[model samples]
Target: MSHADPDQLTLVALGEPAADRSTSDHVRGCAACRAELASLREVVALGRESHVELDLPMPSEAVWDRITAEVDRKNTTVVAVPPHRPRRRVRGLLAVAAAAAVIGAASAVVVDRAATSTPVAAEQLLARAQLSRLGTAPGGARGTVRVVRTGDHAVMRVAVDGMPAPQGLYQVWLYDGVDTMIPLGVLTGGEVEVPVPAKVDLTRFKVVDVSAQRLGQQEHGVSVLRGELG
Candidate 1:
């Protein structure tokens, strides 16, 4: 009936099996959703490409041991890597090969400024907000927001936990807590990077709100979480 769920489309694109069977069927029949899926796949491809185009040598085993120890530590959430099992390949190999051509007694490095640029300097954190659960939100709902300046643009990097899947999609917004509410973008899953509206003044629309909205529904729906920007 309605277009495939955005979150499910992202999961499918990321090599994780679909959570709902209807989403797959809808994607097969709906050209719009299929195109959206393709676009998400491109983003994932670019992330993998960035990792691939690194001109560096593999780190020693001891170096990897240190990384593992950090991951084992508590109270740390690793956002750099996607949680999907199959996508681990991309996260596992970062600057560990791909763009490097090793030779005897010398390391030949070839950095593609074009390919690896997105994941480097473009990711600059501007602000952060710790989202608080709303009255309508689930009991264990929690979210984190990071306003990251990506190259010329700024985006809201939102990550949530214990959030139930919405009937349609979850959308991020900058609410002024009065009249104006600017829609950023559709949130694909537990985490998404939504492009903030251009020329937005955070002083006005300083509240980051995540809402569960139905397909093609105008105006806001049930509020899941909200956080004030600092």
Candidate 2:
């Protein structure tokens, strides 16, 4: 069966009734459509609790340089490169790489200080999706992921639950669901936020993937969880 239109699903998520009776009927009967609606509903709920936007100064150029260098050292690789293909999104995807670099820095420093520190910006979600358990996943594993813009910067927020411990680490990625993927970062907890390059067009990378990987692994590993962004 054809899937529900994503825009209509978004409308339904925003408290608009489905335009067609069949869409409401279809959501009740189709598992994927149901799941997608549930995910969007969560997005709505999160939006209620999300940060209020604020205008703030970008840190110094030296600060960005160091951050950029840190992001460059991650275990990233290009699994496939099409020499002949035209990619308008190449710049944005690479910026996603730059955004992925700040997961470690942001998650640690921001938690305790947000309350007393002068407010900079609050989270405004740009996009989100539901991560489902793939065949490779254990029965208990599942997750939610979102892209948020705060002031001039953006980050990918990932939260997982019911996953068993892995021997090495769990890593996240923005995948095209085809020949290429960019490592977002290692999953540090049940929830982690990784910086996103301002340039990424979220539509170009439709899939959010999580995999169990060894410490030195540069290649994407056995899939444990995956989902598509709507």
Candidate 3:
């Protein structure tokens, strides 16, 4: 007997009636048709079992605004390249290689911007402070801090000048009026924006501190620059 058509086997695997008696008889007797039907049935069953429904929560307006702004910035910088015409073999290969290089560079720039772009929108300035020298910091070491509240969270934008590069890294911290000091994030010299956790109350953790930290040392490190939110 001849093997059954794939369509007929699919129907039989799905428990639907086959097209005719010949296809049905072929499916019953042919080992190939039976194996194919079994595989199709297993796939169908797995697909049905794996289907899931979920209600995803939407990001806040501030988050959306930041995303829109970054997208706009990227779109503004993008240069549209027109399609090139076909040429001689050697020239065509060179043109393709040049085009690939240009595309790769453009992709790198976009990815860099996306990674470095600030996540929070700087809508309202909550507080400003001039960072004063602390601990073993040089007399010339000075910085400026600006705290902005965007949507449900706040961010501290810090600019440090006249300070020598540290041995390890510069870390930003928020200090409550009491003894509690919360590490916000790491700073990358010049100007760096550090995100404040939503659970942290800005009113309570009003002090902004920049610390010179060693690689493995965790606790507070050594405060190099200190400033109050007000």
Candidate 4:
């Protein structure tokens, strides 16, 4: 109410009242909370409108090996390998999962940008702002969607911060001008990576949208955050 709980924010977005009377009362009267709820609702709506489906090619086995190796290198600093008496398997597993989540999250930000606009090299062209401000951090949850082009394909990445992870997995979507939407993929924790489907023309789509999706209702696309591809 006075302060927003991401959980309560979610319930409010779904048009549900909080179970706690005080929280419910606060949400009803708090302008800031209400505005946050509205934004969340809009994102949900955007997800519903997209009808694009991703059929991305997986990285080759050799590529995967390299990726895993890098993952290992990044992970080593986060987790320590223990000596004989006490194995650090649990720590190791958690470290790997965290690294994967970060990678997946960062990759999602990349994909969100690519999906939104016509193919363009990744650059910030704010009317009066410098690009340096846009990327002060490598990948915080609070990143704007960006479109980056590579060879024959475009990638989109949306980085969002503050909101808690969904109960299940978060997903990403692509929306063309005519009310069609596509389910790019499950966001691994904080990021969602979606390759533009081969059948779709990158030049045609103009918006990249991101969302926190619920299971079993795949087609009810709505955007949680969005940016126009330049």
Candidate 5:
């Protein structure tokens, strides 16, 4: 794998690392690198303000103001790349943003539907779906995996039922079509979120599986549950 550029490094510093080789090595080595990555992540997160103007078909004067506000909030400016080339890039960004919004909203719908149902519990459904490491006693426990789509980029939340509390800690993984599972990082707790690789075709892994594990090797073990998205 090739090393990431400065921008990729900046994203990694902000808790959003591109799938580059160097950043992973740095993450394994330096504490300062991790702290810097978190700070950048929080800064990018602050730009997630919901401006009603962005909802309009054509950007209104108000929309431009909100856009500027977002850029200013991040201490960055929107670069106007060559119009022809940028069209594809801009469209891709919009698609991912739209997908993320849809996924986030769907989570609420799932909860509402569960509230009306009798069998499945919301926490259990969420855990099985989103949480990577899950273990349960010998009953029919439930869990939910909420994956939001932003273009091809996916973000997911996991909730589990009957899962034994972590002995120490565990991390999440995104399995490729092959046997290898890439580390997304340590779970934040019962509720944690992470960005899925833009390259991962969700359709291929519709029935993605989650497992509970001790953080020794990057192997999938004792999978607790699995579900299909499409």
Candidate 6:
């Protein structure tokens, strides 16, 4: 009858086992706990779905080992110090704490940068298009596409909604304003990134097309979503 612990509910939402039967029963019966669990699940799903791979710099093992050794030495020295030198001991402890904090902050900075570096670099928007429904698609599906040129590579991010599942798979294509219709990649729905070839000229291939392609089809399929990159 009691409410579930927030920590236990979080763990359960994250696919971890609940702490106890009481927590499990509370989560099942309590509307508030169920809502919180659903919200946490959505957040976890978004985190997993929106993950972008980034090129991150790794700290060397020797650097970590040295930090560990230094901390160990400081701890040992602190403990061995006599009570007569209380002021000196306090100063030493404070210095060690400060060093640890600095190291932790630096490590956190590196990790945060590595996680967010890709999106920042890829945010140089080159072109954008509002994808409109084409042909006799059942739903009033709408989407937006953004093309970004990061360094030598170009990336296209697409977000679509109200799209009913196709018979086969949805594939993205790029047209080079001529006879060439280059296939970028397959789309899984919601939001997806399609990598454009670095050598491909975006000026020529300005058309972004999302098509429903049948299995084993080598040619360009029916265009469901169409947009022109400006």
Q: Taking the tens digit of each residue's C-alpha lDDT, what string does model 4 give over 22-140?
A: 77777778888778667666544433333422222333444344336545664554322222211122223223333454556668878998898687555433211001112222343
Backbone clash tally (model 4): 45
TM-score of each: 0.49, 0.48, 0.46, 0.35, 0.36, 0.49
CA shift at 135, candidate 6, in angstroms? 1.8
lDDT of 2 by residue, 145-190 (tens): 9988888888899999988888899999988877988888899778
lDDT of 3: 0.68
The sequence of per-residue lDDT tens digits that candidate 3 reaches over residues 1-230 is: 45666545544554556767988787778888788778766544443332322122333444344334433444665322222222222122222333333555668889999999978655898888899998689989889999888887778899999788889988988898589999878888567988878787778888988898998779888889999988
Superposed model 3: Cα runs more than 4 Å off: 1-122
Tens digits of per-residue lDDT for model 6, 1-230: 45566545544554657756877787778898899778655544443332322122332444344335545763654222222322223223333333454556668889999888875454588899998899756567988999887877779999888888888888889986569899988889577998888887878888988888998888999988888999
Residue 87, candidate 3: alpha-carbon lDDT: 20
Off by over 4 Å in 5: 1-140, 150-153, 168-170, 175-180
What residue pairs clash in candidate 2, if any at all? 99-195
Kindly provide the TM-score of model 6 when superposed on the true structure, using C-alpha atoms.
Answer: 0.49
At residue 53, candidate 6 shows an lDDT of 26
Best by lDDT: 2
Query: lDDT of each structure?
Result: 0.69, 0.69, 0.68, 0.51, 0.50, 0.68
Give candidate 2's whole-model lDDT: 0.69
Model 3 TM-score is 0.46
Q: Write the per-residue lDDT of candidate 5 for residues 1-230, one digit (tens) a residue.
A: 33223344443433433555766786667676566556545434433433322321333343344334433444754422222322223323333333344555667779999898777323312222433333443355455667765443557776656555665454555554467666565554555677766776666655555566775755665556555554
Model 1 lDDT per residue over 1-230, tens place? 56765545644665657766887888888999888778666555654453334333445564355345433434555323223322233333333222221221122133545455665554787788999999988899999998978778888889999998888999898999998888888888699987876789877888999999999988987788999987
Residue pairs of candidate 6 with colliding backbone atoms: none
What is the RMSD of candidate 2?
A: 33.8
| lDDT at residue 41 of model 3 (Cα atoms) | 64
Model 5 — which ten-residue stretch has the worst lDDT? 79-88
Better structure of 1 and 5 per lDDT: 1
